[model samples]
Target: MFRLAAVVAAVTVMATAVVAQTDVVAERKSVMRESGKYFYGALPRMLRGEAPYDQATVDAAFTAFADSAKKIPGLYPESSKNAPRTSDYSASPKIWENKADFEAKVAAYGKSIEAARPKATSLDGLKEAHALVRAGCDSCHDSYRVRH
Candidate 1:
């Protein structure tokens, strides 16, 4: 009876941990998808003159980028390091392996967003600042996002 109880307790604990990890992974994915609207959506087209220049869209893009930068570092808890990968996107194990470096990269990304936020007032201004912002994203993604 004692052994059965222990087994049940162990299973419960394992299930709880799995739930926590799954929650964090889902939250991170949702955040990424929200911000991707700007990166992969309207912002790029506006920058390239493929879409009309709307101040609101530019402002929203930078705002989302800045907000996501702040939220992103916190989203990658140790519990999430082992989450199953998806063919589309998943946190790279490299993020946990070099946690400090990954966080520093996130900090740099935040700085880039701040630097670009002011410049995003106009299409031309946004164009000028876009490269630095993109570089920040590339630096992290190239090393810390798994797309397989």
Candidate 2:
């Protein structure tokens, strides 16, 4: 009876860990998608003059990027590295192997957002800042993302 109880408890713990890890992966993907909406959608149109520059929209995008920078490192706990469920992109195991470098890139991204937010008030200013911000993203992705 004791052995059976121990087995049941172990299974329950494993199941819970799996569920938690999956949730982390989903949350990480959702955060990235939020930033993608701005990057792949309205922001570029505004930059190219295809859409009118809207301060509120720009502000919202910066806010989303800032929030993502803060949350991303935490979402990548070791357990979530091998979560059974993932999106088209998975975090490279390099993130765990070189955690410091991965986190430094995220920190740089946050700094870029902070420096860029004020400049975003004008079209040209936003364009210049956008390059800096995009560089931060590319730096991290180049090292840390696996394209599925």
Candidate 3:
């Protein structure tokens, strides 16, 4: 009976660990999705050419873009071995398949946004910056993300 109880306890502990790991993965995926939304959703608004493309808007959008980029490397799973079989994930295994290429694009994106930082002092300046930043988004999404 004692042996049986020990076996059951071990099984329970193993099950709990698996559940905890899955929860962590799910949480990470959720955060990655949110970051993608902020990065992509802001682009259309910036492109509208109607919003006050002032310093504040530029600062906010650029800050958000930078934050989102920082999260990208973390969000990408180390391998496709554990990737979800089916879900709303816009990211593709191609990202991991060509990890170096994907990472390079992400780095270029950060550089483009950083370059726009000093030019965002006024509406016209912000508009120009918006264009540059939008281009970066287009570049990455074109290569890495799938529309759903």
Best by TM-score: 2
* Candidate number achieving the greatest lDDT relative to the actual structure: 2
**Whole-model Cα lDDT of every candidate shown, in order:** 0.85, 0.89, 0.68
Which structure is stronger by lDDT: 1 or 2?
2
lDDT of 1 by residue, 58-125 (tens): 77778788888989988999988888764398888888889999999999999988888888777788
Candidate 3 local Cα displacement, residue 144, angstroms:
1.2
Native-to-model Cα distance after best TM-score fit, residue 80 in candidate 3, in Å = 5.9
In angstroms, the error of model 1 at 50 is 2.5
Q: Determine the backbone clash count of candidate 3.
A: 0
**Which runs of model 3 end up more than 4 angstroms from their true locations?**
1-49, 79-82, 85-89
**Superposed Cα deviation of residue 108, candidate 1 (Å):** 0.3
The C-alpha TM-scores of every prediction are 0.91, 0.95, 0.67
lDDT of prediction 1: 0.85
Off by over 4 Å in 2: none
